[model samples]
Target: MPAHRYSELHTIPFYECNVNNRISIPMLINILILASEHQNEKLGVDQLYLIDKYGIGWVVTSYSIHITELPRKDSVVKMTTRGTSYNRYFAFREFWLHDQDGNELVKVESIWVLMNEKTRKITAIDDDVITPYQSEKVRRVPRLPRPGRIEPEDQMTSKEYQVRWSDIDFNGHVNNSRYPEWMLDSLPMDFLDTHEPTNIDIRFENEVKYGNRVTSSVVVDSSDNDKIKTVHEIKSSDVLSASATIVWKENKAEGQD
Candidate 1:
């Protein structure tokens, strides 16, 4: 495996959290993306660098983030990442979340695939990029199941967009956090402006790139007045990039009926 790279420390802001004063799932994804970008930048082999040097693209085909303890606003947090291994078509990475005192918070694992820019087809990982990592060998057992369940959602209320330049990450793909921006944008302004998300579960299935037209769909359940359930999905044509479930809790202020 490659020598350990630096783990960047990031502070949580109130806006990063849902109405519950805890980090939002989407924001957490952003943290991971940020850590990965920071590590690559430090290594001098970051995403854009990779693309400009090589005529290829990388997409986060899968991600599994386990939220152990949610960090609150102003909480000092640390994100650690390591390139684990690669075999055949997959490159693996592991991430750990730590609190200020060095207590473990969350653990994450992900895999990404390289693609040809012209054809937009997934290609194998090029040695030029993978060789430096010298990643450890990982067993191949048909990796874990990814998050993909296709069901029609309510008519998307909000169509706010994320420009190509703004959302692109070091990998030349839309950063994971951008998914949440599309998801939340479809939500009622009143909902996110005042409430917070209690929990969010999402799976990264594919990568949507610059100039890719993405549509956000949401389905909401109103079983309880105080709590609401929402599902957010981002798609291009028939292929899905990611799907998310967000649970919202109203602010603690009086009269939120």
Candidate 2:
């Protein structure tokens, strides 16, 4: 199997950046996924090809992202993605964002699974679908670390959101990018304004369809003023849809807290 890696250069636009002129994590996530979409198109196994031919599509199950520095507005950065390995049920992939000088800015490790289009159930990866990426197949599946659990007894700040049509991707489920946005939005504005995430671990357990209402709940642990940890969960009709843990560092740069 040949190794297939893809990279693309992007200029950060103003809208993609936050109040501090740095690119937001959710937007960066979308860009990383766009890079993967381009790679699939290049390999001729894009969503359309797979769905039309095999009645299947890829869905993200989990992501572990590390942020060294967030790219600022108008900065040109290179985004790269590749399939590390896969098995019958899962595919492991990696993504990296590098600055103009080649310094790593962000790193993302992810797990993906194939889902049947009509049945919306997890499906096995077929040789025809997995072969084009040249990803190695293993009999033993990798054990990725799961997100820290959020106990029901923990006090939480929560908000309700109605899924909009735009939130649905081509797969007919909520876009993976929206999970972090919902999670982050549940935090207090002051915390979000004064802090930036350094590490993020999120797991998607169930799919949320358009028009469904979801409650985003968060628990903040501020015991460490410098390094804060926040636990987040998204639930619809009492079913847990997604959960995430974000580690943040205080932004020393002069700004509103």
- Highest-TM-score candidate: 2
Per-residue lDDT for 171-228 in model 2, tens only?
6789888889999999988888888999999999989999899999999888887688
- In terms of lDDT, the poorest run of 10 residues in model 1 is 141-150
lDDT of 1 by residue, 10-99 (tens): 999988977667787678877887897787777667777876887675566666656557677788898898777877688787788899
Count of clashing residue pairs in every prediction: 6, 0
Model 1 Cα displacement at 16 (Å)?
3.7
104: Cα error in model 1, Å: 2.2
TM-score of each: 0.69, 0.95
Candidate 2 TM-score versus the reference: 0.95
